[model samples]
Target: MTLLLLLAAAALQPAVEPQPSLAAKELRRIPAEEARQGATAGHGSVYAIGNHEIGRYDAKTGQRVARWDGDPAQFPHLNSCELDGRDLVCAASNYPNVPMSSQILWFDATTLKLRRTHSLGHGHGSLTWVTRHAGAWYACYANYDGKGGEPGRDHRETTVVRLDDRLNETALWTFPDSVLERFSPRSASGGAWGDDGLLYVTGHDRPEMYVMRVPAKGSVLEHVTTIALPTDGQAIGWEQGQNRVLWSIERKRTEMVASRVPPVK
Candidate 1:
């Protein structure tokens, strides 16, 4: 697929190692922030999707691979998107990725052809990335309390929806009120699962990082913690100078920042 990657200012904020998985030893990243909604990675490619459009970049060289996307079928909105195994997953939402009426589209990575479409019933939120954890797939959608425009992403509630055989929200895990109260009623944005099996979620606008263990049961999810995030969208990326792994932070006007996860040793 043809890609158009545009590079900009590069900066690496001091990094701090978190856990066994989010440790700076595991990831590599470059500084290219877009009000970055979501990130998708595969082979030698990485996708960073936002409200403007989608971009494909060389994960190794940090070069623009391509840009492909359009308007939402219903509203003029496209939330976040991710890559499943060998396919490209995208979500278009007027209300965070919800709506029994709206759908999430899966396209072929090589051909970019529309393969399958799944619908999330009403009450769903702005869909971000489709995460695969514990041999099962989950769709990450954020419910926002903001009004509109890019700034709206900052005020949202993240919804972790469990898909049934029919791609329905059989069981869902949402942020507890205590965790939500830590930050403003912000929107939950990009999230990713590490090789360590821990699920790291970011508040669209909240200044804290929410990490949750793929709980054995829904009720156990209350253990989710809120760590300070330098910025929004603290998902995953390579720390520029240190060349490590980290939960990348969302940038305001530019792209997201690939802050170091820890001090370079």
Candidate 2:
């Protein structure tokens, strides 16, 4: 009789609603030989980022304007970049190497020349992506579970760190367990803050981007939803003036793709 009563009560409870699935509409694909790692857009141009190379192409004509190649030993792994004002701010790291170190590189947006570099030494995993938002800098530090991971830290250690103008850590937050599960064996390879006040991140090779929000008072970011992307994840950047547009890369095809992301409800 007690079992029957419990079952009746359980059936009366409300059902859990499944998370919504969203898709990005692919707008265009431009051939960018340097689109090996990630891509960003600004100043009527799209920049294709490689480990040690960057190719600037006219967005309208799809013509390569200029390219910059760096010494691999010096600028080993430039994971991602975003155009900031007149400079292209990039996040670089020494990955697949222990005691992971990272740095921030600033380059001339128009000239595609190395302007300056800020070494982050070795601390919060490997800096994979960084962007300026709401008067502060948000950076994603990647911690792998296998190849590039340290002895102790693994994928769970991947974090989003907020820093001041001088690049000093202000606060930090980890990903939720659900999101971490998707990043297992690897980590977040790209991230950016959306105008809707949500944070979007991508795993090493997943074709999905996870949307999250910083909890009111917690160390773990709250998972909002996942959006399907047309390309495998690496690094990404929001379109400069477009409300819901983003630029990403298709590594296998060596192309830079532009997509219009749907707004989160």
Candidate 3:
């Protein structure tokens, strides 16, 4: 009876299919000094990031508000962050060394203080970015042939994994080879779920973001579109309010920038 019920439930699920591409327009750039890794927006504030540091800023005025320094031995590389309710959840990894490991760092949204740490012991590359969608947590576990990733796995093996609220992976999807090829030696650096319900990913040092959706029949995610941005990619965030904007950081200048779909005429 249980088997019959399981099969019946599965039959009612919708089959996933490829989605069409769409373009995002560039709006403006915000000059900043703490955006070495990535940026995100929340609660009238913006968070600019470095590998081991994070700073809070006024979302409208771009003024520095607060900053937090992470321990090098524990939180060496903080690739990106997402605003979850009253908490800022960030992805951190140990890079430029063997046996790569990663963790999730949670911070208080108002105080910008480290609140908790959850380790995702060594497996499936380095955790680059994390976000929550439809009650599940999605994390990008990136790989590379370069200095810091898994030694044997090719850079093409990077994956995005969906985890339950407890951080246990439930489903996984890989990027299309065409997308992976664009990264060359490095792997995916940032990811976020757009307001349109598609997963947007950015490659290392590239000013492009790839749109992807999970396919029903395979482990590979379907490629939707490639949207251009102003700066080389690191991490990204999607602002879902009336602004409908996308945010990123220019690592070289430590600048945070924002872009949005052009307003309809």
Per-candidate TM vs. native?
0.67, 0.92, 0.88
Give the deviation of candidate 3 from the true structure as CA RMSD: 11.4
Write out the backbone clash pairs for model 3: none
What C-alpha lDDT values do all the predictions have?
0.54, 0.92, 0.83
* lDDT by residue (tens digit), candidate 1, 1-265: 1232222222344435333223222234445544356555566666666564666677678777676555545434555555666777676566533232345777776555567776664444556556655656677665545543234334334567767646755667766665565435555555656554566666556555566665676643453545554555533432222333443535554444444343211
Angstrom error of the Cα, residue 59, model 3: value is 1.6
Per-residue CA lDDT of model 2 for 59-129, tens digit only, reads 99999999999999988899999989999999999887879999999999999999999999999899999
Q: What lDDT is reached at residue 52 by model 3? A: 92
Alpha-carbon RMSD, candidate 2: 4.4
Model 2 bad stretches (over 4 Å): 1-20
Better of 1 and 2 by TM-score: 2
lDDT by residue (tens digit), candidate 3, 1-265: 9999999999999866323244466766666677888988867888888889888888878788898987888778899999998999999988766688888999998788999999897888888999999999999888887777665787788888999998888999888987887776898998988777788889887778887888978899988777767779889987647466888887888788888843221
Q: How much does each candidate deviate from the true structure in C-alpha RMSD?
A: 13.0, 4.4, 11.4
